[model samples]
Structure formats: C-alpha cells, structure tokens
Target: MSIVWYYDFISPFAWLQWPKIKALAAEHPITLRPILLAGILDLCGQKGPAEIPAKREFTYRYTLWRARQAGVTLNFPPSHPFNPLAALRLCIAAGSSGAATEAIFDWIWGHGRAGDSIEALAPVAAALGIDDPVAAIADPAVKAQLRENFDAAVAEGVFGVPTLSIDGRLFWGDDAHEFALACLRDPSLWNEPEMQRVAALPIGAARQA
Candidate 1:
C-alpha cells in the first residue's frame, strides 16, 4: 500500500493536508508517492478551486480554519495556478539522485510554490542538493522521466489531490487519511465485506452523512 499524493502546487486543501499526511506516513511505514496535481487537472479538465465563485471564497476560509487545526502554515499560491512541470521535474530529479523525494514534497506543500522564481527555489534546491534540476528538467531524459511519472499516475486511475492507493483501491482527501493509514498498516481493515462500503465514506461521515 502506498500514499499517492496527487496535489497541485496551488491547491489550498492539498496544502492544508500536507503536515498530517507526512506525520501519518512517518508513524506508519507507508510509502509516499508524490504525483503532479497538474496531471490530475489535465485529466479532469478542471482548474484550481479559486476559479469557482462561491467555492473559491468558501474554500479559502475553510482551508485556513483547517490549517489552523492541522497546525500547518501556508501562503495562498499566486493568482494563477503555478506550473507543476518544473516542480515535477525537481521531484523526479530528487528521487533519481537518491534523495528523499517525499521530504522535498513536504517542503513544497508546506511552504514552496511553483510560482516562485528559480531564485526562490534555489535554497530548497541547494538544501536538497539538486543543483542540476533546472538543467535536468530541461533535458530530454529527465523530461521523459517526468512524463512517465504523470502517465503512471493517470494509469492508476488517480483523479484528485491527496488520493491514497492501497492495493488497487483509492481513497481521497485529508479527511480520509485515517482510513488510508488503517488500510495501509493492516489489510484487515479492508478484509471484510462491509468494510468495502464503510471505507468509501469520509472520515466521521458515518455519523455526519
């Protein structure tokens, strides 16, 4: 079982979920896979939440409240959804270089932005020591690698941010992280017939929904 994090650099909800997901992953011995949120958007032909009228405003405040509860600090990404191509390249570069890609993902989600200039990304790149990510990202080889990452994510039927994949099943949202942790650490959580339907509901949804 693996946590396939499908999040864009610009998404507030994904940003809000970052710390808890990492904490959960560390507490459990689960593998974390960071997939491009842009690819998910492409597959769905959708944009960021801020593009919607009510949802944009509503989710912005809602995200802040959740962030407060989650103990995460986030700056709203710039107006336009930042490009994930470079970010994805950087991720692949870090992974290929034998560094902890999930750590880099944590940084980006916790604070970094695709809208940041290369100069802004310099410190993180240096810290991760991925000095050549820009070059690597521009190279045909690494670009192909990034493409493969996106393609693989799509092939797995991922269509949303923070989607966790256990075996072949998918669970989405920060609200679903507990089930993800449960399913990952113990398959018994999903071994029952009724478990199938129960896992489909959101966290606390059995009570609320």
Candidate 2:
C-alpha cells in the first residue's frame, strides 16, 4: 500500500513538508489526500493555532523560521484562516496528481495568494488545463470526494494537516517527517515495549467540558 499524506491548503506546514514528501515519492508510492483542517479540529473539539490569538502569532513566526531553516521560500497569503473548501475541491476535481498538488501549493504558499474562492483559483485551474474551476468544484462528485477524504482522515485518527500515514501509523506535523521516515525504515520500532506502553497509557486527569 502507498503511504498516505493527509493535508489541507490552509496549512503552511503542509506546504513546508511538500518538498520532502515529493522527494520521497520519487522512490516510493505516496498518495495525496486533501482534507479539511477545520473539520478535523471541529471533530476533536479543539481550536487551530491560528484560532488562538497568541498561538496565531507564534505559529506564523515558527513556520517562517522553519521554512528558512529548510531553505524553502515561504509567504503567507494576504488573509489567513480563509475557507479552503474550494481549493480542496479543486484538487479532487483535478484528480489529485502531484503536479496539480504542487501547483496549488505554489499558488497559495509559494506565491502568497488567496485560494478561498473559485474565482481566486482560476489561474490554478487554467494552469492545470482546467477550463472552469468554478464548475469543477461545483460538481457533486467533487464535493462528495472531498467529504469522503475528510471522513477517511477522521477514521484514520488524523488530527492535523501534514500528517503521514504509513503501515497504519500516523506521524503528525512537519516536524515529524523524519520520525515517519525512521519508522518506515524500521517498522519494528513500533513493536518496542515502550511504544506499546505509551500507546496504552491511561488518562489520569480530565478537564470538564
């Protein structure tokens, strides 16, 4: 089976990790799965880093720092926390190819452009040889595929974008890319006693809702 990468256009971390993931794809099969970050956050009853004022500033700074460290060009769109639904659907409509995925990422994070609406994403569609992104994203099939991807992500216990799933193991965040590769290189790592112990650790405290 191919390694599954769950991502959202709203995530700069995803954009940061894309290059490494694409490099990995040169040697291994990787599947691009576009998901709604908001849906996952809602399902888990948590706010995104951007949703929290202090965290938002830090997230932006930290991500930029990371990009610089990785020698990757980084730029935030004019507005953030913008709706990614249209862009997500466009990916699905475009058959989720690596080229299309890279193009979309470049359009958003690389160029610092807003992709919240079909009209805004017209250039991306045109680049992908899609005549009408508006119609493409409006298709019922495209909408359903995006929902299916979200549901699959939830089922996989995915909590965030830039998550890599390999052999039923999830490595979350751009920082976890090396961890994912390590696990892939040594699947037995998960079989360690400490790994099992941590996996079964019981919650000792709870916050009342």
Range of the 10 consecutive residues with the lowest summed lDDT in candidate 2: 160-169
Tens-digit per-residue lDDT, 109-162, candidate 2: 999998999889999999999997888999999999988988889888999888
Tell me the tens digit of each residue's lDDT in model 1 across 1-209: 34455554455665566666667656554444556776677678887576678878888788778778878775564454555556556656666332444444455555544444445565667777767656755778767776675776688887777676766677778788778767777787776878777758667535332
How many pairs of residues collide in each model? 0, 0
The model with the greatest lDDT is 2
Task: Give me candidate 2's TM-score against the actual structure.
Answer: 0.98
RMSD of 1: 5.8
lDDT value for candidate 2? Answer: 0.92
TM-scores of all candidate predictions against the true structure: 0.74, 0.98
List runs of model 1 lying over 4 Å from the truth.
1-3, 27-29, 45-47, 96-117, 185-209
